[model samples]
Target: MKWSIVFLLISVQVFSQKIIWSDQQKLEWSNFKSKVKTMRNPDVVAYTHCGWEYSSTVSSDPSVPVKIKITTIFREDKSWKDPKRINDYALLHEQKHFDIAEIYARKLRKEVMEHIKTSSDYNKNFKIIYNRILNEYKDFQIAYDRDTQNGMNKEKQAQYNASIAEALETTK
Candidate 1:
């Protein structure tokens, strides 16, 4: 008699530059140290790309605890800038974009914590919660860009900044 073990392979484009967000460690233009892209589209002088990595694990025993984590990542290589045109104001807008990512991470943590009790089908439930939070986060990010007109609208920018700050506190 013999036992068999199977492995699943998943291919993903992994970025080497991954910076986890922290309140004490504020993002700076220096942190945007990745090489800038040569194809500098005039409409898009600078970009701050962000995302998250979520994972969970379960033990063979049903009584074993399930572990889960959601990490907010800032892609330095993907996030580019045109120093010739990127100004302090533009940098603030980008920083705010990163802050928005942290906001969602905290919110996701809260949601996941609440559902930890029901770990019978952790993967399915986790996906539902993760996707919902991610969708909402994307929607808010787009709305921020549109409402502030990419930070050109000073009034709207202030409002968004204030709102994001407040949201950060609550999520914590």
Candidate 2:
């Protein structure tokens, strides 16, 4: 039996400098390694660049298990912050953004596993599912920022923090 392996790294933009997300690893001010040339918005304190990547292997032998790996990553070179305006609250907010990406990564893993079980053409199906989920993930990210007002509104931010934490717990 032969094994076919496929790998894909999808993101809004390509990045080489990245840190994989982990439960033990938390975001710190130092992680924002980029220096912003100009502030597009004066109110914006920081930006966290996070996304997901996946790879899968399929075995021709039905007895062999399929291998799918999904990873949530943060791009240090793409993320930046205003050091003067930084605070613990803002850092936590950025951490939650990374957590949100991890949540979506888990979602993608679940969908990929389900699709591969019955898919005759998993490669094509994987792209289709990935693209669909990617769109949703982007929209969700936008909504999160809008709802929390970029973590300015304490009440909304708290709500999102609780929601995101619950999601991570239940998904695990």
- Weakest 10 consecutive residues of candidate 2 by summed lDDT: 1-10
How far in Å is the alpha carbon of 113 misplaced in model 1? 0.4
Question: Candidate 2: what lDDT?
Answer: 0.83
lDDT per residue for candidate 1 within 61-112, as digits (tens), equals: 6556688888888877678887788888888899899999999988888888
Residue 116 lDDT (model 1): 65
Candidate 2: RMSD over Cα atoms? 7.0
For every candidate in turn, the CA RMSD to the true structure comes to 7.6, 7.0
Error of 1 at 68 (Å): 0.9
- Expressed as tens digits, the lDDT of each residue in 1-172 for candidate 2 is 1222222243423346788988898999998988873447678899998898767676666545567788999989889999899999999999999999999888888888777663344645778888888898899889988888889999999999999999999888
Angstrom error of the Cα, residue 12, model 2: value is 23
Backbone clashes, each candidate = 0, 0
TM-score for candidate 2, please give it. Answer: 0.81
